[model samples]
Target: MKKYIGILGLLTVAVIWGTGFVATAVALDNYTPFQILAIRFTVAFLILLGMNITKIKTISKKSFKRGSLLGVFLFLAFAFQTVGLQFTTPSKNAFLTAVNVIIVPFLGFLIFKKKVPIKGVVGSFVTLIGIALLSLTSSLGGINLGDMLTLVCAVFFALQIFVTDFFVDEEETWVLMLLQMGSAAALSWLTIFITGEGLPSIKMETVFPVLYLGIASTLIAYFLQTASQKYTTSSQAAVILSTEAFFGMLGSVLLLGEKVSINMLIGSIFIFIGILIVELDIPQFAKKQG
Candidate 1:
């Protein structure tokens, strides 16, 4: 039951994150990427801090350090992705970002000496193809500056998942989450000043989107990611979370009334197959049949 809950939690986050593209679009009208991140993480940190104030005393030095480390990786991932967007199209960025699904299992093996299940290796490849179909809607321009940065962003994201899986077992979930949020917020605030993009005046359009992103996408989704990793392997979690891209595509079509294409339907089917491959014991089933 705990495992099921973990799977469901990841799926829920995937759905919410899928919708973030729209909210981000609205917010971008009023703020730069750094400014948006500053607002999002600051609001999320405050909310998490408020909700968990009574338990602050329980967080140890080691937990704080681990969470801060993870937060730095998280910040790098988002910062690279946002900056990469300045030079690349969103479709290319989306495809490259999803490449982290392929990176996660390899990082697990290389860092911890943990063996990735054969199914996981195969599923990651399958999911990579699906993401390509869904996100590569345009002709390829030779890999440019933004594409390279987005690829680096994928590595950072993959590290975040594996590192969170490593530390979650040793730390309390809520405390770790709060520390991570706080650290990311601090870094983002610093970047805002360094970049010389002063805060723009806020309007109602920006207010609602920033609020949703801070509360739902950052606080709730990240908390769920930390907690759910307790019950799921890092590679399995990566495969599940990769569905965020699929959900993002679906949300655009449904909520924004964007037209769905044949490629989108085909890509969704491929992703479903990839997820099933990771979640099921295919080799054991084959043995049973024999």
Candidate 2:
């Protein structure tokens, strides 16, 4: 039951994050990327801080330092994605950013000296092929500025996942979440000033999306993700979270009227299959060991 609940929570996170891509695209029309991030992170941080105030006070200095490092990685992940959206279509951005799933295992192997499973290597190749199919469009032909930035975002996101996995202790989930969100908010606001972009007037349309992005995507989804990870293994969690790309594509089509081509459908299937292969293979390997 706990595992099922965790799975459900992860699916919810994927859906919320998927819709967030559309919301972000809409918000971008009115405000710059940094401005949107600033508002979203600020609201999310405040909410998390309120929820974890007592825990925040109890966090040790070492825990606080680790959490701060996680926060920096989180900030860079979001900042890169937000900025990359400016240069690419949201659908493309979504698929490219999802490449972090492929990057994560490699990062773990490199940084933590973990051994890479053969399943992971095969999954990576399959996912790369899917990315090629998904990204090949008539207008774009090959990679563009937006795609490059989104790819960079994928790298940061992979690092964030690895950092979170390393630093998240049994005692400090809520406190760490609050600190990370607050740090991201601070960094985003600083970037806004550094870029010389002043705060823009907020309209009703923009305000609603920003609120949803902050509360739903940044706060609620993140909370769910942390909770779910407690019940699910990290490999399973990664597989579940990879569905965010599928949700993003759906949201783009439904909300933004983005066209879906035959190639996209085929490519999406490959991506799904790749993730399924990884998901099934890892658990089976674990069962064999047991």
Candidate 3:
């Protein structure tokens, strides 16, 4: 029951994030990337604060520290991604960001001495290939400054997932969720000031989508992710969450009226296969020498 809940929760997170791509596209029309980040995180943090106000004073220093660490990674991941998008194709940015799915297993092994699972390892690569097919409209262009920044962004995202899995066991989920959001919100606001993006005027069209992003994408999706990781390994979480790309593709086709090519369908199948490889325990047929 717990296992199914964990996977289902993570799937919900992926779906929310996938839909967020559409909201973000609409929001980008009226706001700078930093502005979007600031608004979304601030909105999420404030709501969380409202929900936890009675217990605010009860949060411990240790909880605050862990949340702060996660916040830093979370903020950095988005920051670099937003900036990286400027110099690279959105396709590249999207594909590179998905690289975190591949990093989680290796990071676990190297940093925590956790044994890597063979199927999970294979699954991640297959998923990456699928992402490449889905995201790259053409051949991958030469690497550039933006590509490097996006890769760094991927590393930070991987850390966020890895650390969240580790810290979920140590801290109250709500406390961790609220503080990390607050920390990310604070950093996002600072970035706006640093970049001198003085208040971008808003309109009804943009406001609605931004609000959706704040509530659904940041608040709900992240809250679910943090909670779900409690019942699953980070590797499984990473692979499941990579389904965000698959969902994003679906959203684009349905919402944005993008046409699906043959490769796209093939890619989606590979993604499904990859997910099965990670989630299902396949029988090994190799004979052992007695």
Candidate 4:
């Protein structure tokens, strides 16, 4: 039951993160990327802080260390992704960032010595193909600085998931969540200063989008991820969360009235199959054969 809950929670994170694209687009009209991230994470940290105030004193040093490390990965992922967007097309950035589905297993094996199940490994490739189909409308273009940056961003994201799985069982869930968010917020502000962007001035029009991103995407989605990763294998969690691409495409079609192509439908089908493969433990036979 906990496993099932974890699966559902990760899926929920995917859905909320999917909608975050829309909210982020709205917020971008008013704020720069670093500024937007700063506000979003700040709001999330504050809310979690308020809710977990009583437990704050009990948070262990290990939890702070792990959470802060995870926070750096999270911050780097977003920072590279947003910066990469300036140098590459959104399609390229999206596809490369989605490569986290591919990186998680290897990182898990190398960094944490976690053996990825055969089925999970297969599902990651399947998901990658689906993401390519969904995001790559153009031919493989020349690799640019943006593409490289986005690929690095994918590594950071994969690390974030693996590290979350690493620490979730050892620490208080809320404490980890709060510190991770707080660290990310702190990093974003630092980036804003380093980039000389200064702080962005918020307007009435920006409030709704920033609030949605803060509360829904950062706060709710991230907390769900932290709590849920406790019950699921990191590989399984990565595959499940890869559905964010599917959800994003779905939202575009449904809400933004974007036209869906045959490729899109086929890609979505493949993504579903990937998720199903992991969820159903279809690799048991493969393991037995090995």
Each prediction's whole-model lDDT (CA): 0.78, 0.80, 0.80, 0.78
- After best superposition, candidate 3 residue 197: deviation in angstroms? 1.5
What TM-score fits each model? Answer: 0.83, 0.90, 0.85, 0.83
**Candidate 4 Cα misplacement greater than 4 A, ranges:** 85-96, 112-148, 260-280, 283-289
Flag the better candidate by lDDT, 2 or 4. Answer: 2
Pairs in steric clash, model 3: none
The local distance difference test score of model 4 is 0.78
**Candidate 1 lDDT by residue in tens digits, 159-238:** 99989989888888888888888998889989978878887566785588888988998999999999999999987787
Q: What is the lDDT of residue 70 in candidate 2?
A: 68
Evaluate residue 86 in candidate 4 and report its C-alpha lDDT on the 0 to 100 scale: 62
Q: Tens digits of per-residue lDDT for model 2 on 147-245?
A: 778888888877776666655445356776787788888898889888889875778856988999999998888878776777776666677787888
Better of 2 and 3 by TM-score: 2
Which residue runs does candidate 3 get wrong by more than 4 Å? 84-96, 115-151, 262-280, 284-290
When sorted by TM-score, best at the front, the candidate numbers are: 2, 3, 4, 1
lDDT of 3: 0.80
Question: Could you tell me the lDDT of residue 165 within candidate 1?
Answer: 89
Task: Assess candidate 2 and give its TM-score to the true structure.
Answer: 0.90
- Per-residue lDDT of 1-290 in model 3, one digit per residue for the tens? 99899999999998888777666666776888888888888899999999989999999998899999999999999888877756654434555566787788779789879776777678777977775565565667534777678778989998999999989988888899899999998998888888798876777766888888889989999999999999999878988887786676667667867676776677667666766766676765112111
